[model samples]
Target: MKVAVVLNPIAGGGRLKRHWPEVAASLKRHFGDFELRETQAEGDAERLALDLAAIGFELVIAAGGDGTASEVADGLLKAFRESGRT
Candidate 1:
């Protein structure tokens, strides 16, 4: 299964950035392999997710707090809406 990981490096004051190596390994163990996309700034995750979804990502995962998750969801919704998918 192809998976997309949208990670916010600045989340929790750079906690994700510090522990990403181990975290990525753990995710790999479970998900096998994934496309990792780092956020350059706020809303980058959303834009990235939207682009991924548009290209046919079956699963998209978002890291960070609720804000990041919300943005990702919004992007996915917008993509689906624009595509006219039910």
Candidate 2:
């Protein structure tokens, strides 16, 4: 599955940003290649997820806090609706 990782950089008060290099390396080691988007504002992850879905990614992994994950889910659902996905 082609995965998309939506990251909320401010999730843990910037911890994700601080340790992203290590986390990214680990993801690359495991997942090989994934579409990664670091959220800059509140709704960035959702927009990113919508964009990813618009292009038809098979899998999308929203890596962030509850709110961020929720936003990504919302975006995916919106895209699904717009695309007529069953």
Which candidate number would show the highest lDDT if scored against the true structure?
A: 1
lDDT by residue (tens digit), candidate 1, 1-86: 78899998889999988999999999999998899998888888889989999998878898887888988898889889989987
Model 1 — TM-score against the truth? 0.91
Residue pairs with backbone overlap in model 2: none
Candidate 2 lDDT over 8-59, as tens digits, reads 9888888887898898889888888888888888888889999998998867
Global lDDT scores for all candidate models: 0.88, 0.87
Clashing pairs in 1: none
- For each candidate, what TM-score against the reference? 0.91, 0.86
Q: After superposition, how far is residue 32 of candidate 1 from its true place, in Å?
A: 1.3
User: TM-score winner among the candidates?
Assistant: 1
